[model samples]
Target chain A: MKRYGEFNALNGASFQTGEDARVVALLGPSGGGKSTLLRVLGGLLVPEEGSVLVNGVALPKDPEGALEALRQNGFVFQGYNLFPHLTALQNVTLPLMVVHGQSEQAAQQRGQELLTRLGLFDHLHKRPAELSGGQQQRAAIARALAPKPRLLLLDEPTSALDPVMTGEVLDVIRELAQEGQQIVLATHEISFARQVADWVVFLANGTVQESSTSVKFFYDPMSSLAKEYLTALTKYR
Target chain B: MPNSLTRRLIWTFVLIAGASLLLYATFASVHYPWNWSNAWSYRFQFLWGWGTTLAISLGASIVSILVGFGLMVGRRSPTTPLRLFCHGTVELLRGSPLLVQLLLGYYILANRLNINDPILVGMILLGFFEGAYLAEIFRGAVESIGASQREAAKAVGFNKVQMYRHVIIPQAIRRALPGTTGQLVSLIKDSSLLSVIGIEELVQKVRIMNSSSYTALEGYLPLAAAYLIVTLPLSWYASRLERRFAFET
Candidate 1:
């Protein structure tokens, strides 16, 4: 994570957790460096001076570095950005062929299985435009979880959705939590975080403002920034 | 009704104009018409010449597409030097006139390098020229793809090449198609310029016929018709391809 410009997006951000960790939520104001931290972990961006460890080993960023980060983690975006050109099926299976070295048949089979699991079986042949917002979010989730990744990074998984669609997406997220995979989600969803987030990490101004069990963070957050944020947020609600 | 009436009027005017031109040719050629006995001799020559033009243009287009895509990829490379080199190659090709490139490629460089095959040189020359333009088209399409798609692909465990091959290129190529097809038509027309280098394309062959037979109308009329016949269907097909696809929007 070496950026040439002025801002340090992830200033002194640090965390450590178990291998099968589930739902550690990154709560933040916009441009608070939470997404940058995720990008560093995703190996899409390299930090100037930080070591990202997975099971106590340094994540590599060399030839197979991005692929290596890709291997361990699946990233979900707020926008549910599926490829408009490809059918839902092709979008899911593409990485299987390119990185996992799966045969086309295997990729297709796996893609079908994943889409089916996400309740997108009937929607598999249609392009993203044909899907509802929730369906597209599920498709994005299916694409992420297709390889049974060890860790998942979700950036504001429900930030852009309507209230009904947000609930729909949160239900899927909860279902994933029940399956026992590690997920670190960056979100603006307050009550949903209280319900499902195992731990809540309030990040603001490029540093960790507070990290607490979801109960304590919602009921009695320590940091002034977290307190102010939750106050401002709940005021709107 | 108005649109249909305008269309009918256009067709009527086109047919009348064509008939008048043909009648004028009949008189101009009456003094020395294309002798039916001699038609076969010249027709075969025209066929061979036109075939060369088509081959050159098509071959050039294919080469240009592959090369241009490679250049686009290189331009998008993370390493600065590689990106600079790709950018320089694009700028160099776009800046120079294709005619000058043709001369340099077919005569000067080919001779200097001891490359005797004019056909290969000609194809490379045309392909490289068209490729530079196609590179920009491809680059724009690639950039236009939502960063979200690339992120999604990467998030799904695709490396850079995988992201490009699986996600980016397919989407980019689709958007770039109609524009490239239009470019291909222009490339086909541009192939006639190769005749200046003694490649004996349709235009050059027509010139030979005009001089040899001393019947400008007899020679030029059919050649112009041939060029139209070859180009029109292609242009019309390109128009369909531009409009028919749903993914473009």
Candidate 2:
């Protein structure tokens, strides 16, 4: 549970990932604590009451220990927060060299590879400002993947992109999912969630209203709150 | 582009030459009992004073920028007491007039601390005074960065030091540069305040020359011109920097 002064942002929101679920999606409305939950899972937020465990390792309270635990997760933010001062290549290679302590040559090679794979090889020397929204998000993904983190956490990755840009970014993520990368993304794109995610978690008012396989959750919701959410989501689709 | 810039430069130089000639003609023809020769004679002393001013400004600016960086870090620290201390320090220094701060440093603080070097004392006082303003520039620059960047840094598994060194400070410094240059120009002007403590800077030398020669037009005019010489190019370069770092979103 997490409290923002008097308001409870997360009220005993208990959830357990399936043993085989590689791509889990947190589906919900605005202010539903989906982003908060993703942050907690990524070890970015220390919940006031409950513990977060990733890959059987409990996230620690000490700052140093938290940094160590955070190494396992790579996050892609809604804004695609690429370092503005650095070129796309530098944005990807910086964390590898600085955080993971990779050699310059090694980091460069890895960054180049990832950027190329994301179809951004020509844009390597360009700064984030020079890239389109979709390209910037791809560079952000390359940056997140450079460290080879165990899990990827995406918080509303497509929220800032237009429909075309959204499709482009989602395609990159879908490719990663096909490659068997473990991911937990908070998204409002219900169709994308249904197509990409193996497990779906419906969150409303800081509580987990329903959790099930994506197929079941999409067609048959267990909770009335989940049903209402599905109805609203379907109306948009 | 080069040709146009060169033409502009030539025009600027022509304008300056014309202004100097006009000023010389005005003073030489209108003013009585004026010895332009006597004004030229004080060039050596004036040069020395200019050099002293430059040295003080350079030393003070370096110290000020470093102190400002430290204060920015302290202000952003997670610990409540440390953050409060940083805020209070910035507030206290900024709240007082720099002239009063200099007076205290030279008159009371220096004596209480038994500091003998007037130059060193001047640099420290000036640095601390300017640092308060620079701290605000740095703090504002850092704060202007999106919170998403900080979160991205943490998610990349960066410790605080690594995060700041690689991600935060570089961008902050870029954003702070134009403002910093402006402050440094202010520092250069403020360095004249050191004359109160008998530091033989530009203004002090001008004062001496005016007293001895009794030619306000001859002595003070060139003194003003000398300050312009130092500050004009700086202002130009700062604008260039503003354009250079103006990242388009």
Candidate 3:
């Protein structure tokens, strides 16, 4: 949660998860602390009052541990921001060599295998500027997936893409969820949320207005804020 | 028409003066009492002088990048002492006159320390002198890469060292090239100053010949051509690199 100059972007907001929900979506309007909540989860923010419990440990007590948790978790941004100087292979292999303690040779080999599997083998040597929008996003997904994190955190994964490109990137995410990876995303792609998200959270003004199964959240939102937010978001072209 | 024609002529004059410089050694090679024995011998001297100048320039550039890279990394270190030390080094190098640093390094440091090798002294002084500017370019380039980039890498489980070695430093180096051309060209020109240090780099040998031959034209004209032969192609490649990184960015 963000402390934006005496205003609490997320004021004591709390959340819980089901036993085996694979894809959880934080669906919300702008300024609702969706990004701030992600920042908190990513250990980039510290609330003035209250704590975050992840994997049975309270946060901010140990900044180092919080950072480690954040590291073990993968974050995918909406912009598909890849390093322009680097090739797809180098981008994927970086974390493998950095975090996972793999040698350059091993990382290169695995990076090659991952990119080939992602259908980016041909683009392996091409810099980010040389790749198409969809290819870059797929390569970003490949980078996130390389370390094999337990929790995959995505920030509006498909917002920057056109409908066709969105479909292509979302398809990769869908395939990942099908393989039983726990996917947590802050997104505005309502269609993907409704279709693929097992659990959905509707946040407004820095608080979770509603949380329920995707079927229930869409078909019948309990809060007026959630309904209005969904209506406004859906009405947005 | 006359006024505009005068302005056009003046503009062309300025272009010639700026882009083309008269080489002192070129006239020295072929004119006056100290003229070379033949055109073939003059051409050979010219080629050798140009090659040596290129070597000096290239050598200075490589040293500048390596030393600058290390100083830049030190600037980013979290430890207070290391950071301050790097900061002080950059300030000392950039603040003091480069010529002074070169003279100081050559005379005070090298001479008293019994390091009689003038080539080694020239290399050290040139590297240290140019590294300050290079450090600034590198630091700015690395900083301009958005904080989001590093945060993303950190989240992906890469440690601080890995973040720099793999992702950040490479991008920073590539990004700094445009700003760095000034340093590169300056370094090349700066090599001429090394003649005073007794390094027989292009300009030094010409000075030796000039004093002995007593003919400015025969001793200095070819040396100037040699200098151009080294710098012109370098500036060309620097321009090409600027264009490439512009598109990449």
Ranking by TM-score: 2, 1, 3
Top DockQ prediction, candidate number: 2
Cα error, residue A145 of model 1, in Å, equals 0.9
Scanning candidate 1 chain A in windows of ten residues, the lowest lDDT window is A13-22
Q: Of the pair 2 and 3, which is ahead by TM-score?
A: 2
Indicate whether candidate 1 or candidate 3 has the larger DockQ. Answer: 1
Question: What DockQ results do all the predictions give, each relative to the true complex?
Answer: 0.50, 0.74, 0.44
Expressed as tens digits, the lDDT of each residue in B51-123 for candidate 3 is 6667777777899998898898889889999999999999999998877887888889998999998777787
Scanning candidate 3 chain B in windows of ten residues, the lowest lDDT window is B37-46
Error of 1 at B219 (Å): 3.2
Tell the DockQ for candidate 1: 0.50
Write the residue-wise lDDT of candidate 2 on A1-237 in tens digits.
Answer: 978899999997888878899999998889999989998888888888988866676789778777777887799999888888889999998888888889999999999999999999899999998999999999999998888878999999999999999998999999999999999999988889999999998899999888889999988889998888778878855
**Which candidate, 1 or 2, has the higher TM-score?**
2
Q: For model 1, which pairs clash?
A: A1-A46, A1-A47, A1-A48, A2-A47, A2-A48
Model 2 misplacement above 4 A: A55-57, B10-33, B78-81
Which scores higher on lDDT, 1 or 2?
Answer: 2
